[model samples]
Target: MIKTSGLSYAALAQAVNRLGYLAGKTLNYSKSAVSRWIAGEQPRNPVPELLLEVFRKKLGREFTYRDLGFDIAEADIEIRSLWYSDLSTTLDVAPLMWSHDVFRRDLLKSSAVAVGAMTAPARNFLPFEPDRCRSRTGSIPVSLGDVKMIREVAHQYWRWDSKYGGGRFREQLVYFLHSHVAPLLGGRYGEKVGCGLFSAAGEATMFAGWMAYDMASLGLAQRYYTQALRMAQAAGDRQLGGEILTCMAYVANSAGAPDDAIQLCEYALDITKGRVPPRVQSYIYSVLSRCLASAPSSPRNRPAALTALNAAERHFARPLDGSENAWVAGIDFRGLQTQAAHVLSELGMTGRAHEAISVALDGRDESHRRAVAFCKLYLGMVHVKEDDAEAAVAAGDEVLNLLPGLETARVQQGLARLQREINSLGDTDPIRTFNERARTLGDRS
Candidate 1:
């Protein structure tokens, strides 16, 4: 692989560090470390995933751990097949993945897993039979009532994650997964109860995955989401599967692969067409718009962005029969408008972006403190585009005030971008003042 890619050990180390930073981790492997790996000592959990990513980009092909001579004879195929494991197999792996995440396994720390490996799960589910997931149990006994309790607990975790941040209770979800849910999967049950149990576990896994995403634990998030997608498909919950696909899209876009983001979003839309709640459709479309707008430098991407933005708005404004799932219950017109504003900003339509951003900022819910902080940064960017330095600083300052104790990757990234934009305004007093403040705050992070 190195012979074809012509990448040196130092370059490999640099690429690993860059990926580590992007994943919000501190994987600073040295040039000697790469040399050691090349000498036949297998790289650890997330390290293998990262190296595969480097060679993938350098050679433009997909590579696996086996290609790197890693011994997988003792590895769990179910966990490795996280994208689309079968019912009992998926249940077996979900608890283990949570355990790995709780323990911070090497696999959980390497965010590069999502770089190329996430797409196949959605494709795997395209022709999935959610019913064939039922399986025979071993010893103890599980009841439908037990499944209900799992669902209830999962919902509570979701609410906590929503009101506070995922940092507040993400670990607790893993605890529940390990302590309560794992044993139940080993318990005895009929087909009906089996499906219900898997569905309940999927709920917990999905919520836990989203919390990981919110807390910016990228590798863990990828592990959880891929497992959750398998669980969702196993239970025949197409809606939940689509939701998992959408979450994957968010991670894809964040990792600078807009094409992966677009693929996942489109897959979600394709699988759930006319079958999902309108609000869910709105959420998917809104995410799709963001992915499209991100690539607006291309003529094709610009019109596609506009089209997706319009579609999201239309879907958001569609009537609901009040049967929306609890997961998408918070995806309202307000969030739609906020994303629309960002898309417009990405498209370089300053007037429309400013107008949309202002609408998003107005009548905002204080409960969504993070959203408010992000929108403020968006406002600052808009002010920058309009050459209003004073207004931009005011908007940026508001963001700082709202930023205490919140260090999510998205928040830190937006802050960094805002700092760069402010610095570009030269050595003026206000710009310099804000730049220093932003730089200081950024350094602390």
Candidate 2:
């Protein structure tokens, strides 16, 4: 297994220790401990659990004690696939996914391919028939206070992800969800409590998904999002359900499936039934417009894009009534304009795109390095579109400066894209210099 991951035992031990630290454990793991395990002694208590995560993340699948040469009993979950019709099965699986994901970092090694993963999950999202409840009641009596705690924790994590990149906080967030929240599922609760529990857990799952998305692990994000969708449906949280679908739409858009993106957004709108707050509605419309504009110009859904964009603008123009869903707390004017800028640029509205993006860029929080990088890249693209070589070079340079400490694949890809655009402006000194640096953006070492 070490050979497969191309890691020495020392390196693997180090990885395990780092992940454990993120889980708030204070332990020093020596290479000899791993050697002792190889000599037929299983790691004591939490070490084995941590080791399992280390290897599971090293390889993108579950592992056993035997697989890693540790003499320990195997703990497995009966539920695995998201295709299961029973929401209870999904609830059972959420913790399983969270356990693996908490310390699992291998998924970030590549951009997960998005093909048909969401189809099964989204089908389940469409106003489905409720299944017989199968929650196994535990000793702890669930309460609204517990639900509120989960909601608060999930909201706090969202703010963290918005400020720091997901790569910075996903491990800690997943650790809380898996270690703290998952155990609650086994404790006894009535249907009402179950709904609240699932709803809160679903938000945690969505946060996990969003973090993966921020890291550019589209495929892993899909798995988490799929579970989130099922959990929300079981809880009958319609607003959250729509938010999950919209998240899927964002993934689809990034994965080069613009038409699929548009379809998913429409499905979300259908389920929302105008029940979402006006701010949330505007967010939904803004994303839909971005998708429509992303399609190839020949068959681009411009008419639909225009309608969606207009709706977004109209809704955004309304004052905040403090009635918006908590899940969409950051979906304000700047976020709307970010999508609008992209749509307008795609529609050949260069001047308006430039103005919109400039404002979006100016309004971005410096703590949100990932988003700041994206705005800079898009701003560079707008300059390229307007045939301003000097301006494009300047925007590209600033964005390049921001990329050194960021570890996100989508951001790197955007930089590569900006480089390509720069290349088309002829091989001048600024273009050539920017192009070379951009090529190194994907250098992992």
Candidate 3:
């Protein structure tokens, strides 16, 4: 028989801390336990998996139990893909996805692509009959039957994010749903009721992912997106599947994976083909523009982005049917224009970018502080690029004031870029005032 060497607990803890740096998050660990582990102590169940995470992150390699000084074990279990009828299992998965974003940042960034590799070949999961399942008790839960209520709450939270930015209420919302709302999902109900519950869970999970993404927990965001995708697939919600895909594409693009983002956007478009509402289609196209804007600025690529913007505009111009959900339908020409503005700004087309930003600002409401802040940020950058220091400082001050409350890393990147521009001028002029304010804003953020 071959003997496997175990890691000392202290060595294990040292390894985890090293891995945390690579994964871009802090790991709470001590040397003594790691020493214990190396002394042939089993490190505990979750600890082993966390060890795997550490090695995988730092070494760019996957780990088996053997790598952690344990006897080779069978592959760790994937979270079971339970149907809505499986209330206990579904509940198990919901909190797993919900709480993951609180700490796991690496999971949010690249895991979507990691999952993509697993999912791309099979496109869908093993089929399960929706008819065979029943709720825990014989009765359906009230929460399951009332999906609109959950959607309304989600919209309200989305609006809150738009106003106060994501930092204001994201954690509060997650805690409420995870603590109070999630229990009801595990209650007894028929298949009909169970499906509704799963659908709500899916929506909530998607938003949780979005909140994490906004907060720059890229790894956690990706994990939540993957969970949301699985839940949507189980619920047979094509619309949601598309929405999640678009969101994933946004994250990919944000992370500098333009090609991957474009592919995901195309996948979203193809899945919806003919069935998606025009407004939803426009929303998807807007995200496509975001991805394509990151593409190399060749004559061809620029036209491709313009084409997508035009397609989005066409969809926005269409009349909505009653079946079109209001939140989805509310995405119109102005929203497309807003997206186009940002894309133009990113591409350094300052003239066109300014035009689009002005139009977007005119149409956006005062309560949309996130949007307002972003537009000002863009305008400030444009002014700096145009060598208008006074104009840049004025617009940047507006961005600086609101920047403290926004949790999005993209927002911080914008501020950083602006500071660099001001610093490049090396002027002790009032223009440098923007840099100081931005530094203060950075500290708060």
Candidate 4:
């Protein structure tokens, strides 16, 4: 019997895809080919050599034929041993169990210990307590290693996609979260590990929701967010729960449900009252401000926005302890300022909006290409409003330069809005010509 690495199918698939893509193949071999190899049909002649070459290039390592061996008979036995033999349950769960190893190479190695062939559900698959695990675990109970790895991957995707355009990766992440991780939530673990798993799953689910929102799939995003909220409740992580509620409010506000947004934000604020870091509290308020801005004009809306802005200001005025969640670390006061600028702009408070934009721009890190694109768009919009076509055009051009790097949908939407504004000024103006150029660049790219 050939003793191979015992890598899960997904890892090998990822490796193959990476190799094929690097080699510039128009259409690489199907996954079935690898499936066949794993099924114990020995690669004869040049194909075996080709496999070695592909793996070496893909993984940056050398391998002997023996290194990739597996017994044909054992393939089914090994797979069934790793997961339950029940096809129905395995269909629902194998992906999620295997996904654990996807994030951590060591976990995959450990998984090769092979689940017991007792014909019963694995030890990890606990009975689903509908009442207890109703929503996201309130407090995560899993090991620190799992928590850290999930966070690292989530943050990496968040930052990278925000800077580079979600494109196919956005879809890939959503699929993996839904297909490869959801089943683990159904499996058993100790209370400690269970809570931790729920927390990590909840966070990953929320991130999937964010990507959905970026793709303009509001309905799907809502579902993912709801699932995330449930996972948070299961983890018993109130802080994370509150944060996710605030995120849900953002989705609501974006979809024109300001009233819904306001209610959700208030609920989150109440839930986290006094327990959360000031940074989180500030974030909640910033989101609330968006709700207030979008709400129908009334004394209540004005006062609400003002109150939220004031509270955010007070929070930012204080020095944050280093213990805050890393996600909320750099959330400076400019976020509040940006919110103010947006609201003022909507209210036709042009001077105030411009002033706020200036302050926000000053505070923004231009190194973050997305932030620069946003600032430029906002500034351009302000100029367009003021009939400063030349200035608007200049700002729009800058937005175009950064557009190649910006992956956020909001930036693209902002650019479209600016283009409309420039277009309203007629086709012959220099501003119109500049807008046309920017539009072409985006369209062509």
Candidate 5:
């Protein structure tokens, strides 16, 4: 297994020791010790567990003692409970997941992304019915002010994620959710306060999911999204529920499940029809546009994508009467353009795609560095498709400049795609310079 993973014995030993230190134990395991373990000599307590984690991280999947040919009893690992029958059950299960996310993040990060797990939440939430009473009778008392604080903090986290990228503040947000907000969920609160608290908690949880998605931890993101949907259902916030489903759809599309993504977007649009504000409707339609565009290209797909995009634009032009949910309030016209750019690009409308991407880039400020980087990447790819090497190189250069400050895997992946596009443009001086600079920056990263 170690040979198959391409890890040297010394590297494996170092990884084990580092994991041990992180778990608050200090031990020196030499390469020879690793060799002995490989030769069928069992290591004592905690070593086996650490080895499993090391393999899990390396392989991007869960591992067991049996899989490693270790002659030991397989430890019963706790599978995260995602679905719940009632509000109380959800409250109990969600904190456990958050706690694991905070303390056992390695396991969560390497967990497989289960596309099927998404169905239950959407199935339960689309009915638009509120859960049973959310009022709790724990020792601590929760107030509307507390709920307000959670919402504010969640908004702040969103700003940080947009600016610094998810790798920077994801752990802090999960810790905040697990340590501060989990207790509040179990505290004493009236019906009104309970609804507000659940809504606030749902927003925070969804943000956590967004951060996970940003960091390329798709499995962890899915779990957080599922729980957020559950909380939204309990809060009876159909708008928020729809928004969460849209997020799930985005992640689903990114994970190569366009069918699931389209279904989720359809659910969001169906459930929130006539209930949400224009901006919220625009957000849903925009996501639907992207999902439809991602499907196998066909005569109907392009028209369907354009229709969704048009619906998004029409709804976005309507005047805001101050009733928009905070969750969808940030989906401004520029945000809609970003999604439009993607749909157009997928539909092979390079000229329109370039125009839409430029609009998105023009509207964003410095605080949205990650978003700007993504827009630039899209612009570069569109330039590539247009056979304009100079323009593409220019946009790629801008993305390169932004790469050093950002810590997002999505941006890295985007840069890789940009590199591939530039590589396709022959061996020109500008292309050579761009690739060299990209290589240097990537090495530094």
Candidate 6:
């Protein structure tokens, strides 16, 4: 592996040290240390993990310690099994994942995003046969009321996530899933009740994934999403499954794999077409528009993005009687405009982007603080794209004001992008002031 990678021992050592520094450690391994490792000497804790991360990034793939000829522990095997495991194994692994995420985050946080790992779940879901018999034998008896409670809790968590950001209640949600929900999966239940339980579980698990994404734990988020997809498939809930895929597409696009994002969105649209409510379809198209806009700039992509955005707007315009799923309730006109703003901004339609984001921000109250912050950030970006330094500064100031109460990595990432855009315009007085203020708040965050 070392020879094929063409990385000299010193380069390998340097890469490992860079990862260590990012993790708040001081590593000083010399070229000889790398040679010793190549000569069959095992390094200490974190070195093995760091080595795997370095190779994963270098080769654009995932690697386990066992793959690198290091001795693999049983716990490591279980930790790596969630993404590709069968549905039954996934039920067993989900709780373990939550427990580890809460208590031993280092096991998962150090891992790099494996783009390949996302492919199998999306592909396997296309032809998945819903489990016919969901009956399980355990101590506790499950009921529809229990499923309803889980759904209610998930809805509350969604509200909290929108208001305070994903980092605020993520651990609490994970604990609830582990302590309360996982056991219910094992408890005795008939087929109908079992389906409801799995659907509820899928929704809760997808929230976990969204929290992980907002916290910038991309790899961990993918695992949660994969498990959620499995749960949705088991429940025979294609609409929910498609929603999960839409989320996976968003993550993929954010991680610089827009092609994967586009494919996932297409799969989502394919599976959910005519099967879901107009609100849900509108939500899917909104995401598809964003993904299409983010893809490599081409003539085809621009028009395709516009078309998808139009579809989203059209779907959202249709009348609704408030009978949509709990998850689809949040996909309102403001959210659609927010997505439209993103699509427009990515396609370089600066004026349209500004208008769309302004619509998104209109009448935004305290309940949607995080969403408002994101819109402001994007508005700042659009201002930069338009070379409007003063407006950009104002947008940055608004984001700085909102930064204190939010715990989302995505908002911080947006601020960073805004900074980059400002920097590209050359340093000036207002830009300098905004940068200084942003730096101060960023340090605190």
Best by TM-score: 6
Question: With candidate 4 superimposed using the best TM-score fit, by how many Å does residue 130's alpha carbon deviate from the native?
Answer: 12
Identify the superior model by TM-score, candidate 1 or candidate 5.
Answer: 5
The predicted structure with the larger lDDT, 2 or 3, is 2
Predicted structure 1, TM vs. truth = 0.79
| lDDT for each residue of candidate 6 in 403-443, tens digit (9 for 90 to 100) | 88799999998889888887788778988988899888888
Q: Rank the candidates by lDDT, best first.
A: 5, 6, 1, 2, 3, 4
TM-score per prediction, in order, is 0.79, 0.77, 0.74, 0.65, 0.81, 0.83
What number of backbone clashes does candidate 2 have, counting pairs of residues 3 or more apart or in separate chains? 3
Residue 353 local lDDT, model 3:
84
Candidate 5 regions with alpha-carbon error over 4 angstroms = 1-78
lDDT tens readout by residue for model 2, 234-293 = 787777888888898888888887777888888888887667667777777888998888
lDDT (Cα, tens digit) per residue for candidate 1, span 235-332: 78878888889898887777677898899999999988999887888888888989988865567988888888888888878887776766577666
lDDT tens per residue, model 4, 11-42 = 55555554333322223445576678878777
> What does candidate 3's lDDT look like per residue over 28-113, in tens digits?
77877665776888854445655765554455444567866787453322222211213343456566544443345233233322
Worst 10 residues of 3 by lDDT: 76-85
**Residue 261 alpha-carbon offset, candidate 2, angstroms:** 1.5
How does candidate 5 score on lDDT? 0.83
Q: After superposition, how far is residue 169 of candidate 6 from its true place, in Å?
A: 0.9
lDDT by candidate, in order shown: 0.76, 0.73, 0.65, 0.60, 0.83, 0.83
